[model samples]
Target: MKKLLIALLTAASLSACTTTESFVKGADVGWLPQMEASGYQFRNRDGKRQDALRILKDYGINTIRLRTWVNPSQDKGSGHNSRDETVAMAVRAQRMGMRIMIDFHYSDSWADPEKQVKPAAWRGHDFAQLQKDVYDYTYDVMRALQSAGVAPEWVQVGNETRTGMIYPEGHTDNWPQLAKLINQGYAAVKAVSPSSKVVLHLDRGNDNQWFRTWFDNAKANGAKWDVIGMSYYPYWLPGRPDYTASIDDLGRNLNDMAARYGSEVMVVEVGGEDDRPQNTYDMLVAVQAKVRAVPGGKGLGVIYWEPQGARSWSHYALSAWGADGRPTKAMDAFLRQP
Candidate 1:
């Protein structure tokens, strides 16, 4: 009877241990709540920066990530945001106790794997000078933010730079120059504030090979980075290779990145909320679960690009309807986490 009791007690203790580990892993995993986690994705509409700020503060988000284009030439009959405009928003974020993360796109418009249209002013600059352009622009922005009392917590040298930022020049497959230019921006950011952490980002977290190829080259050339950031938009990543295999593959790959790079891995930008929030919300929750469940996965946290913007177009077209949308389902997803 005593042996039976002992066995039962041991089983109960093990069950309790399992429960404790599960709860802590989900709650205490490195979750950086940045307002711009995926907020605008390069387009800021209706001066919605203020609304962005309020939502973040309400949700305990301590970080704000903002992207900048070198000279995003008035695309589609719209004015591009300038350095001064970025600083202005950074100051507003500061007033509310949020740390800024500056993202340099290094182009006239967008800079990613799919698109990187060089600025018209930079058309004449050679590779050597192009590297300088990246460093100089990064330095100038940091200086302005410093003077304005809005120091950045982290600065991303470039966005979705799987192939490296700045095309035909700073582009990878030309690793010698590519890595050097990346280091130049890193140096520029360091020159101003050595304490600020530098983040190196890439898209398609599902592609371990993409990260491996880039980081392997970067390591060969000695890249400087504090955090490894990945962007995972559910609709986008699954189509990359094999959908059935890729989801689990991404979770494993992220764990591998943290160990391989020896850097804290941050999802940095992730989104859900399809044409409607129900399906996407569930997907986000499942991704969150996957991260927390995996033993080696440091899974920082999943961020919604623009949960509020899911139905934004309808509102702008008609002032009569007003905003009936709140991030009710999205918020519930995070809150419902087990």
Candidate 2:
């Protein structure tokens, strides 16, 4: 009887030790709630105007990525991507049992490679003050989400920081400054939620050389993060005509980066031409295949950037929506079982 009990207990222990799947099939629907607020609706194949989250769930999207702006109210409160707004979206996604990734732009508006405008509030502050602000703000945001019982699975320190974030102060040319700011944000994230994975995001996934230089400098400068997030938008790159080749290289680069860094990699933002939905589908299939093929499965997942932007308030192109407010065939790529 004692031997039998020991075997049963050992089996129970094994079952309890089973690890959850880490692959992330995600979507950056940051504009979703705002779209809904603007009276836009989403529909599935059946033509019923269902909630966007339900549609995404049906498409096999297990994660949601939301972006937050420091002070969007500067534009007459047109800032649906504000802190409070993001928290509300997180609550809704949590109710649906979907994982969450929060992106901090650190500016009043967009903060991509070309434009990293300092928020009005922080424009006059020196570098020291900016670092402290980033730390405090990141900590406060995480605390707020924790207070609401919404623990984000991933938190990005900045968005598409190809050349670094927050302009001249934190630009890539100044790796030390950039690394300092990122470390501050990373420390804040850990302090608030030790389980959440922090991501350092950048654009142009096909550029492996760029990543090597950036990561090498970042590491040498003492920057740390759990994951490397990259954005791949074929239409926006200079070699738009060679997008197919670029897509293929994107997969290879992701694998190389993941293996080299000993860290997980995710295609945090991806979009394709709206006119060629089937082509978009094929691209997603190719990209996802490459990501999943990473050695030891370090490739985490792919995320569509604003796939529901059918006549969105921002008039952004490269969305996966049809004229009928339904997802194009391209979105079917995410339906594959993980």
Among all candidates shown, the one with the greatest lDDT: 2
Q: What's the CA error at residue 155 for candidate 1, in Å?
A: 1.0
**What TM-score quantifies how close candidate 2 is to the native fold?**
0.91
Give the CA lDDT, 0 to 100, for residue 157 in model 1: 85
lDDT per residue, candidate 1, 169-285, as tens digits? 777868888788889999999999888878898998777888988888889988788877777765565453323445676687778787787776666665543344565556656
Pairs that collide, model 1:
72-108
lDDT of 2 at 72: 85
lDDT of 2 at 187: 97
Clashing residue pairs in all predictions, respectively, total 1, 0
TM-score of 1: 0.75
* Cα RMSDs, all models: 9.6, 4.3
> Each model's TM-score?
0.75, 0.91
lDDT of 2: 0.86
